[model samples]
Target: MTERIRHDGIVVVGAGLAGLTAALAAAPARVLVLTEAPLNAGCSSAWAQGGMAAALSPDDAPELHAADTVAAGAGLVNAAMARLLAEEGPAAVRALADLGAPFDRTESGAFAQSLEAAHGKARVARVKGDQAGRAIMEAVSVAVLAAPHVQVRTGAKLTGLLQEESGRIRGVLALIDGRPVEITARAVVLATGGVGGLYAITTTPAELKGEGLGLAALAGARIADPEFVQFHPTAIDIARDPAPLATEALRGEGAVLVNADGERFMDRYHPAGELAPRDVVARAIHAEREAGRGAFLDAREAAGKHFPDEFPTVFAACLSGGVDPRKQPIPVTPACHYHMGGIATDADGATSLPGLFAAGECASTGVHGANRLASNSLLEAAVFGARAGRAAATQNDAKGPFTAVTAAELPPVALQALREAMSRDAGVIRDAAGLTRLLDLIDALEAAHGRSAPLVAARLVAACALARRESRGGHFRADFPGRAEPVRTVVTLPALERPGLRFAAE
Candidate 1:
């Protein structure tokens, strides 16, 4: 028999930055936070190296930040959403600092900022160089643990969404201590990070296989931009699962990309060289690796002796991989870094389904249109997370008969197969043939393992990627090499029932 519990408050799934932020903001109203792993583990927020992006510098303005965000999104960005994120970003960063994030400060006591890929101005507020995510999450975790109205429950893995017959989500079905536990609440907030684990090589926690997104889709929630996924160009090329990252700050500080022969290669790819948009740089590195020249990030001249103090995280990762950044050019590769698409939501994190909300990388709020601006992810998480929390606090429990929606679990072997297929086909560069093969694999896996969450998420990415025939942003197609009309792909499971059916383009 399954255990059932009722909580007269909001249920927040995930324990990352967004989840904790939402929990903190939903104060006075009781909040039950659930996580598959212990706090600060199995979360991408803690692994993030790049700091949050905001217009905190005197020379920078919110307008400029918004403009850069739109430019990086490559024509599909929602202008209003970008502007809203930019306008609210500064305060969000300052708020985290107030919570004891310990952001690097200038001699005059102002927040020190760094220049990343597409930003025209230096505006990324960091912590001890590349320790932004860890430090910020530490501070937020402390606050959430101390908050009176918040109750955190670890070792609870979300398995399904409990929704009313009217499609109103009322709670979640989770697996706790190897038993099925149903927890019903007034509102459910999904901040379950990204789909990086669906790929073989990623810069995110391997446990983040997009179960939240898949369960949401199965529960009839709308999904947006399912084809756009960002691949960071400089994930350290050690043979590590969920690859370690070499933050873009190194490039900002004058690092360069080079081939195996010690030849600089970025100049041949883009005018910005080491600082090109993520998509461009990823493609460049991919092309180099495919050509057998090999790709590397030459940061010897950039940090050199200051490597230990400036980038301790990266320095440790390199050392573990038997490569010293001070003496050797770090081998690099493109890996799944962030998902630019997910359960579609509005500016306030409210999804189409009533009583349900999403934030963080798992929710596509249109701030990141096709490709995300560098370092903007953390900012979006903090900004929209609080918004979602505040909004969910006002929701009252629905009184109606509801059905529990659950999915089968994909076996480890099948999941590994799926991950390999995703990395090979729907990865940095995609085309029709590869995408079709990927879909076929997903179909086979589903036929054998039932409609598992990972398979559903993988199908969403492949099907939508196959439907969209243009090369733009992170989704580059070799067959359709040029950009066509700019349109956002919006989908639901019902609409994807028919093969070759193009999703509703917004």
Candidate 2:
């Protein structure tokens, strides 16, 4: 059975912080929000524990926050964007608080802040220590439900983009309960999360297989800096598919990374020890684990007695996995955590494609250049998601009537193969041969099983990784051992998929 309904409302493709914020910001304009998971489930936004970074303290300032962001980004960060995010971040935090988010507060009613890695001061605003994301999302979800202009539909996954022959976005095709439905939308926002599921070990939701990024790219949107994927150094090494994160705040609180010999190893790699940039920490852990010396995070001294209260989420996850953080050293590994590259967008979250805007993890706003500063993900979502939503809401035009196509599902075997290849080739530590091998495998999979969303996204990452010949930030190439000139990588689908494309660095 086919159902056709036309409305002048905007269509928001994700239900995370960005999508929800966009929907709220659109105000009285009608919005139709679609999500594959239930409102708060399967989104990286809800799993965040480090809280949002903002210059809310009296001693802190936006300029300092922006400086730390630029430094951690490893030279590719746009100075203006960093400054914008830092300056506007406190407002976003306040807005979330006004919407009923229960952020932790001091006795004097100021935001109770905690320090995170890379930040110059105590600026990360938390909620009961580690409940910031859950609390904020819960508040936003409630606001969205009460808003008369926003209508939400869970379990509806985006399949493809509908476009006019003139190259303008017309609508979106999605899969709803095993059936295909097309919605003619005036403006579409892609807030779908990152491509962490592409890796074997990740701290992101396993269901987020880069569908949003792939769909946008397949529709011919420009992609930028696809190689920069941040690997969290302390994913709890429990036997979980998508590992649970041991928040970076632990390191800032004095947690030390020690190998099997009970040796504190990070001091030898960088002077900052446990507080170095994420990419540096991840590589250090990777090197330790690879050398047969298993790595562990001993949080016994840092917030030891207060573990349960300080970071309830981490404490619960650890106890459930049969390790108590107050005593035992928690096993840790570097896992895919965040993607710094995605469907390239402008300052206002407008993508290269007309009528399509992207925000959050799916869009590369250049706020995060190579490695993202700690706790910046939530800030970016709140700030830019509103921009994308407001921009999309202003666009009011429905495409001439057309049938919506159903999204194709990728086979399990093919999906598994692709994930393995990505973990092996385009992972935390990479080389030219591994990246090329990953590309060859992607080509083989696409040729055999057709173009799956995950494969398309994987190809973009591997292709870009192959082209970048530097060990900068999250994208560390052992073959090209040093950081060269910091020119950004911008590529189109056609350029990447060229028929005889012998991939070469730009």
User: Best candidate, TM-score-wise?
Assistant: 1
- Residues 1-506, model 1: lDDT tens digits: 89999999999999999999999999889999999898889999998888999999889999999999999999888899999999999999999999999999999999999999999999999998999999999999999999999999988999999999889998999988789999899999999999999999999999999999999999999999989999999999999998999999999999999999999999999999999999999999999999999999999999999999999999999999999999999999999999999999999899999999999999999889889999999999999999999999999877798889999999999999999999999998898999989988998999998998888888889888988888989999999999889999888988887856765465
Q: Give stretches of model 1 more than 4 Å off.
A: none
TM-score for every candidate vs. truth?
0.99, 0.97
Clashes of 1: 0
Rate residue 110 of model 1 by lDDT.
97
> What's model 1's TM-score?
0.99
Displacement of the residue 214 alpha carbon in candidate 2, Å: 0.6
Top candidate by lDDT: 1
